[model samples]
Target: MNGNTERQFATNVYYDRTFDCDAAKILPGEFYYTGQDMLIVTVLGSCVAACIRDRVTGLGGMNHFMLPDGGDPASPVSASMRYGTFAMEVLINELLKAGARRENLEAKVFGGGAVLRGFTAMNVGERNAAFVMNYLKTEQIRVVAEDLNDIYPRKVYFFPRTGKVLVKKLMQTQNDTVAKRELDYASRLKVEPVAGEIDLF
Candidate 1:
């Protein structure tokens, strides 16, 4: 495993009474994958999550991430893109390591809400939405479903074993927590160096 993978893997495992299954809640820059039947969840504000799984084996995972403030979107190796790349690669590589095949991968993406105030100029939500879609396309992973940029924050629940996702769009009035968390995550990105390179498998 690479350094980034070690640091970014989600560790908040819990049992969800509501779903009667194990669950992992991934925060910004974190990802979770498992071959066992389980739920992976996250809340997003100007960030995105990709729930990827193998159609044949039901092995999969989810990742929550946002590209840092600025970088040339056209340059695949730019700093911001690199952060996004590592977030994605770490999740996909983990799934592959757990016995998922490259040919059977499919994706469902959600989040990237324009709920953050004073961030309209940067279009952070829009950029993140675009980046994930483009990245999946370049990787030849089929996007089975998506709920991209909008003006409301979202709570995403993903069942990797069944390739099922449930998305709840939060009212603008109730988005304070989501906004604050993402804002703090973005600030940390500005100061912390991006995790080391992770090669996609």
Candidate 2:
């Protein structure tokens, strides 16, 4: 048996509670799921994850983030979700809080695309992909599936209760997304305030 398959699991549910996953935005590392409910989610960029589940309890959560903080003492748990450092922490904590044990967790990963223009070959997508793979490797979490590292954006739906995901590839491979991102970045750039001079009469 493969090392991963030997460690994988499937959780079954007897009853489910429905939760409305509306347009409400979820930040990085923030996992959302009802105990027995199926969830549909969406994201529009490059990121990577370890989607962990408990087979016996039918509980699970996914960790999707970019940078790894390497267990820094100063690491903010909230910020770690945005970065790789605390993403695993947040996911594990969320799942544990929901009553899943560490041994029962399995994973599926997605995202990490380089769809924008002019980022050379190795960019955030590549970095994110690498970090996720390395993190999963170190953690020994079994990856059930992975869809990553292309020149297109994807929309993802994660069913936490069932550990199933549906992905849709978006086909805007031009500079449109780049232009929009650049515009937004430019808008956020700070300019120094001009010092006021006394007006001469």
Best model per lDDT: 1
**Model 1 lDDT, full chain set:** 0.87
TM values, all candidates = 0.94, 0.64
Q: Could you tell me which 10 consecutive residues in candidate 2 have the lowest summed lDDT?
A: 192-201
Residue range with the least summed lDDT across 10 consecutive positions in model 1: 1-10
Off by over 4 Å in 2: 1-29, 68-82, 119-121, 173-201
TM-score of 2: 0.64
Q: Against the unseen true structure, what C-alpha lDDT does each candidate score?
A: 0.87, 0.53
Q: Can you write out model 2's per-residue Cα lDDT over 8-107, one digit (the tens) per residue?
A: 2223222223345432223333444345555535454555645567766768655445442223323333332234544555566667767887677777
At residue 42, give the lDDT of candidate 1.
Answer: 93
